[model samples]
Target: MKILLVLDNLSSSCGANVGIVYELARTWVERGHEVYCLTRKDRFHDIDQQKAGLLHMVWSFDVTEDDILNNVTKSDKWIHLSATGKAIFELTHPVFLQKMIDKKFCESSEIRNEYRKQIEKLFKERSFDAAVAVTEPFYIADALASAKVDTDKYVIMMDPYTNNPSTTDRTRKKKLAREQHVFESARKVFTLDFVGNDMNYLSEELLGKRVNFCVPKVKKCGAGRSDDGATVVDSEKIDFVYVGQLYEDIRNPELMLKIFTRLPDNYILHFYGGGCEQIVDKYKEILGDRLVIHGWVSSDESALAQQNAHILINMNNSIKNMLPSKLIEYINTGKPILNICQIQDCPSIPYIQKYPMAVNIMPMDNDNNIVTAMISDRDLETMAMEVQAFTENYQGKIVEHDVIENIYSDCISENVADMMLEEMQK
Candidate 1:
């Protein structure tokens, strides 16, 4: 069976879309099925294309800053001749929308039309047994619809459209229309987390569509070096680490800075990844020698950094269900988990809290209480043991491979159905 995976920016490691595509495709390839990645040509699009061992095709479209700002209207009156052209221009080109909210440009008709045109052209040459459309937004769904794919299509829903508080008014309308199309048109819907049920409610209210939920597999890092040859700092001189975007809204790295700064001189904090560099720089100025901001470590190096750290920190203010894909890699490393974000009601949160090595922190004084629960020596010892146990369990876990293999098996089973249906005509 051939499976087609479609996404806008398919190369991003930080984004959920690429993570799902890579994990699913890796599993599909291992199971001996052909996998194709269809995405728009963009900055990060080429990064993992070859690594995935999947066919890569890009829709011919380039969105520049000039196209985003609706500046075309200022230069040429012809673009405003019809509402469709204006709306299409505004939706596909997102320079203006970013000014409103740091949002993606997949809402535009121009982008959708390009996706549709390219996909249709590809379909004329190659047919797929099944397709998985990830991150249901307006333009992607519209493109799928324009390509006229049938009801057996599957779409992985991340968060519903309304949950994005930063959505622009124009984007909101376009999102509503496209989301409706996805729910009504796609054969099935799979959500990474439990948020899809909420999305289904919104979908039924807006588009009269029903959605299904499936737990997406958590990802593990490519194996890292054992700490054998690495210099093991004395227990008192251990380092803690935090990786990924650090900003005020989702991850308050500032708060982490305050807590780690107050720690005795023996402790160190290594910061990796990009975004809010100034914020991190401010901490480096204050914490000086205690804090090291490495800024954007390579994938392999970052995994090594996680292994070297005495403790690895993962925190986010997004809804509890908003699991950072990196957390899975963090878990696989078997380091002590210091989770700053906690929700008692979320399904996954309970498992994390149950881990004897996990420290679930909540605000004790104000909105973000810098003071976290005490990390006693006994707790650290227990955590170290848990880390060892976790690493062993995750080391080449057949279950992770199994989940993906099952999804591929499900995809290939359709080939059997196709054969059965053809035989029935006999």
Candidate 2:
């Protein structure tokens, strides 16, 4: 079997998107199938050659230097209208330049045309059994949908549309339209969450049909230690570790900071991602030695931190249906989880509640008052007690790793690949 994987960005390490793509490619190769990947050249240039070799071919696309220079120096004076004349140029020039800048000098029209040309060339060059395209940057998915290929195409919808909040009305409308187009055009759509027997209303509303939702498999990182044989946590203090992006609105770091300040001196807070620099600086004096902020660490270091921490924290205050990729690694540790959510009925709540070692904290009320209430001395004290109790009870306890693992084994890339192959064959 021959498979083609399309992604906008592929990092060297095991990031959320990269990990899924890499694992699928590796699985296909190990199963004696050929694989090809198409992605941006500049971003994925440094991928490990040996690991990349598993794929039969990796095609990268980028704007050439000549194209950049030509677009920069080219004048738009010739593009004039009879009625508006120079006024049209004044209004449209800025918009054109912005589009060029926003698209990294490869204009949308050029990208679509070039990508179509490339896809056509590839179709003529070789045959493919199936293709999988990620639905971010929707244009790539649009391009793949329109390609003149004979294979069945699948769109991997990692995050549902309901979870994405737009800044403006126009942006929201555009996103919705693009999502609708991609979902409707694909042969089959797959999501990373196991939405279970209950249908995902948003997905059905968008696609006009039910889609496949698969849980993600968790890979076990060796027993909670780094290569140097040193533990990832401090033995004296109770370490609370968080490892992922800290968006101000969605995954607020402010609430975490407020909670950390009110906690007891024995507790230490560690942040291991970008976007919390401003918050860290603001609370530096108050936090003093209790806060350890490592701006961004490699994927391996992230796994090490997850394994060593006494407790793992996830703050999803805004998004309801989406699950953070870091949660999988956190659960793999068999340690207790402190999941802070804005809504009581978040999709993750049921799953987290089922895990004996995990605790789900939802706001008492449904409004912003929850933030104010959560930071109160009384509320903070209660939370701290809960954490203490959970840690004491679950410490050194052995969880049924296989039983937990069984829940997600079907969602692994190998299984997903097999499903795709079967679907294509049918």
- The C-alpha lDDT values of all candidates are 0.55, 0.63
Q: In terms of TM-score, which candidate is strongest?
A: 2
The per-residue C-alpha lDDT of model 2 at residue 159 equals: 60
| Alpha-carbon TM-score of each model against the true structure | 0.69, 0.79
Q: Return the TM-score for candidate 1, rounded to 2 decimals.
A: 0.69
**Candidate number of the best lDDT:** 2
Give all candidate RMSDs, comma-separated: 9.5, 7.6
Number of clashing residue pairs, candidate 1:
3
Write the residue-wise lDDT of candidate 2 on 1-426 in tens digits: 787787755556535766666766676687788888776544324456765677888776774532543443333333222436644544667855555465643326556556666766778888887777875545677778778788777777666542355325546555556556666667776665543233233465554433555544454333332233223345568888898887656666776677677677878888898664566678777898898888778877887787677788877646555667666656655667888776555666655765667877653444533454345566666656666676666543434555556665654456776665566556
lDDT of 1 by residue, 1-426 (tens): 677777765553536455645655665665566767677654433445455445544333454532444345434463225667766656775766453233345445566677777777777878887666666454565577557654256566665565554567766776666666766666555554455545543534543334433333333223232424233456556667888876555555655665565556766778887665566778888888888889776777887788777777776554444555565555555566667553334334643553444565544333332322343445344434443454333322222323323333322223323332232223
Clashes of each: 3, 0
Question: What 10-residue stretch in candidate 2 is worst by lDDT?
Answer: 222-231
Q: Where in model 2 is the C-alpha error above 4 Å?
A: 43-45, 63-114, 194-210, 220-235, 368-376, 396-400, 410-413
